[model samples]
Target: MAFRVREFELALMHRMQDLNAGKVEEALHGMSASRAELRAAHAHWTRLAHAPRAPKGAAALRMALGAPPYRGSRPAGSLTCDVLRWPLPSWPGLAFEALLGPGGEVWNQWFVRPEGPMTVAFTDLTPWACVVGDLGASFPGAVQIEGPAPHHWTVDFPHDGRTYRARFVYGLIQRLE
Candidate 1:
């Protein structure tokens, strides 16, 4: 039970205020808005709840400036090498294909190694970027992004170098389902 994507856009703004207080279904696009356009889409879902995750040369120009994409399904569970920052060949990396979803693969894959002296801190609960793992390799796992809601990403390998950390604290549930 994981959920994010701004908690399903704030549960679709409380199901659009319980379907405008009358509550019913069947409105695939019958759409209705006002109350100042649902308070500006509820302030764009509270600015996507503190959206961040763009470092290292600006994640490809902040994902081409309109990033809100992720959509590869059928992955209910499996793949959790307990945060896979494996011995990845003692570090000499290059696995960058961040963001695709919307039915494509790679909803995030930034294994940008080369801090050559060990230091990696890719925290999600909101420390977006920190790389300096000075090259030893242990970079681990994290991949869950099927949004409209529910987002996650992890890639670490602290080299046991005595100074590598991780932290992610938005809704909680880093992995292990």
Candidate 2:
């Protein structure tokens, strides 16, 4: 079967379920999907991701999500890297981004707010409402810490003279600590 964007989103939810099963379940319901569907999507995604014959990097992404709506270049330390972005149905305001190295290897893949000035305040830090980049932009002083597991991240930011830690799975905010 051909992998598609919906399967990509479901695969994302599969990783996110570790942090917020309830929210993932609700999303599955909203998509008119079931746990079995989620599992299958994830399995399919895994196969495509690791298959030796499968397209890699941008080609793979295009195969799954079609041509990206946005493509550009960004600095990656001493090297410049290519960036590709696609909008997802689940998050209208955010975009899924993949950063690729010079050799066309994917360096990172995550959700990011499209270019614009974001005025996110502490009160806006709700679960599943924001991405890691949003907090870094809104809270300039935010410090990133290693997450408890892979595909997870934690950021500590100051608000009202106190610090708060935001936990994320697959770069999407999961909870506030």
Best candidate, TM-score-wise? Answer: 2
For model 1, the stretches where C-alpha displacement exceeds 4 angstroms are 1-42, 45-98, 101-126, 131-149, 154-165, 168-177
In order, candidate lDDTs are 0.31, 0.88
The TM-score, computed over Cα atoms with residue i paired to residue i, of candidate 1 is: 0.21
lDDT of 2 by residue, 27-101 (tens): 999999989989999999888879999888789889999999899999979999999999999878889889999
lDDT of 1 at 55: 32
How many pairs of residues in model 2 come into backbone collision? 0
Q: TM per model?
A: 0.21, 0.93
lDDT of 2 at 12: 92
lDDT of 2: 0.88
* Residue pairs with backbone atoms closer than 3 Å in model 2 (clashes): none
Clashes of each: 24, 0
TM-score of 2: 0.93
Q: Which ten residues in a row have the lowest lDDT in candidate 2?
A: 110-119
